[model samples]
Target: MTTARRGRPGYDLESLLQVAVKLFNERGYDGTSMEDLSRKLGITKSAIYHHVPSKEELLRLSVDRALDGLFEVAASTEQLDGRAIDRLEHLVRGSVLVLADRLPFVTLLLRVRGNTKVERSALARRREFDRLVTDLVKQAEAEGDVRPDIDPAVAARLLFGTVNSLIEWYRPRRGSSGAELADAVCKMAFDGLRA
Candidate 1:
């Protein structure tokens, strides 16, 4: 067997996590093994262990990165300080940006089936984010910015469903940016929902 390269100065934890996340996205968290990761990184399994304790830890870290991006947007001053309708729009646009920027991590997050403890935790956090958006929808409805005819919970689900579906088919166009795509989502979502 060819011993993989060793002592590469650039193989830090962050870079290793990126490779691990990409592999997880491709092969799935449950299907991927440390051996597969080592082979893909061209490093020994020992080298990978030096960065993370185990594959589950890597999965936790990756999903956390995706979750953090979302929570940060929800907690941002812009998201908190606006009209309920505008704040909801900011959250939707921010989610699209996160999905575009961290496509692999977000994709893995969305596909997690709760088979592991890490995956279950990720799902719980996702539900919490959904609740926050639901609250925003309710506030918008109360403020008359959003139509009161639709249930807030259902509206939030549909709104996020549209945004989350980006993970399935979004690809980077040559000139279009995440912001541009987010603008389109906000326009399409709000134009119909706004009262």
Candidate 2:
């Protein structure tokens, strides 16, 4: 049995987060003020404060949500134990699902420019995630699974540049399911890179 969370009648953390992400995506974080969130949410600033300590807290939560999802996929036992190429594929597929399921959070995350401490922290996490991908690419190349000519870092960026492009036009309830999209990405990305 679980007790219900107590909060103001209309707005909760989740809803606030949803609106905040939307506004952040639309107006840019620096451009979107607490006033904007309060107005768009049809609530007072103090009401928003009740849910989050500050606007930066909201930014931290949203970006962390996206980063945490990707890191979870990267750290999975399946991802850890596979051949490097296979593990890379698992990482890509799981990342696509993460982007699809948490589209808004991921969008806000990708748009971060390191303008503030929260953005800087998010960028650091992004770099760590990139390092994981680059290491895998190098391992795969060493194993003769990936092409030798390409730099591992370049290959890693290209692979994820493809995955990250999905955020540009992908919309839920469109024709492609996340699994189908992941399969397409894997086929397109791996076929060309595989040696």
lDDT for 162 (candidate 1): 94
Off by over 4 Å in 2: 1-9, 77-79, 193-195
Lowest summed lDDT window (length 10), candidate 1? 1-10
TM-score of each: 0.92, 0.91
Per-residue alpha-carbon lDDT of model 2 for 55-169, expressed as tens digits? Answer: 9999999999899999999889243775899999999999999998899999999999999999999999999999999998999999899999888999999999999999999
Clashes of each: 0, 0
Alpha-carbon runs more than 4 Å astray in model 1: 6-10, 77-79, 193-195
Look at candidate 2 and give me any clashing residue pairs: none
lDDT (C-alpha) at residue 130 in model 1: 92
lDDT of 1 by residue, 111-134 (tens): 999998999999999999999999
Clashing residue pairs, candidate 1? none
